[model samples]
Target: MLGWALTFAVLAIVAGFLGFMSLAGLAATVAKVLFVVFLVLLVASFVIRAVRGQSVL
Candidate 1:
């Protein structure tokens, strides 16, 4: 998921550089959403592991 976010972020940057405003905006939005989801999942996983008395790492 994080990888996907990074990919979209890069795509947004490239698209913006090429003056594709719509594409860049869409890609940026996707990247932001994916990044938020990734963070949520990561925190949830850590909490679950902690509750289970396991190492989060």
Candidate 2:
């Protein structure tokens, strides 16, 4: 998921450089959403691990 977000971020940058405004905007939005989701899941996993008395790292 994090990888996908980075991929979309790069795609957005490239699209914007090529003057594809719509594609860039869409890709940027997707990247943002994916990044948020990734963060949420990461935190959740950490919490679950802590609750289980396991090392989150």
Candidate 3:
């Protein structure tokens, strides 16, 4: 979910600040993947609703 992505992003920032390069990189990668997945799901939901003649908003 988007919340999970944000959580990982924050973790990445904190890890980077603490100089945990490996952890930061891993967290950042997870955040990016989650965010992309979230966006894809969101768009798919919108398209589905539109096709059903329902409000996307």
**Which residue pairs show backbone clashes in model 3?**
none
Query: What does the lDDT read for residue 34 in candidate 3?
Result: 100
- Candidates ranked by TM-score: 3, 2, 1
Native-referenced Cα lDDT, model 1: 1.00
Candidate 2: minimum summed lDDT over ten consecutive residues — where? 34-43
Query: What TM-score goes with each of the models?
Result: 0.98, 0.98, 0.99
Which prediction has more favorable TM-score, 1 or 2?
Answer: 2
- Residue 8, candidate 3: Cα error in Å is 0.3
lDDT of each: 1.00, 1.00, 0.99
Candidate 1 structure quality by residue, lDDT tens digits, 1-57: 999999999999999999999999999999999999999999999999999999999
Candidate 2 per-residue lDDT over residues 14-50, each given as its tens digit? 9999999999999999999999999999999999999
Q: How far is candidate 2 from the true structure (C-alpha RMSD, Å)?
A: 0.3
Candidate 2 error regions (>4 Å): none
Residue 1 Cα positional deviation in candidate 2, in Å, after optimal superposition: 0.7
Model 3 lDDT tens row, 1-57: 999999999999999999999999999999999999999999999999999999999
Range of the 10 consecutive residues with the lowest summed lDDT in candidate 1: 36-45
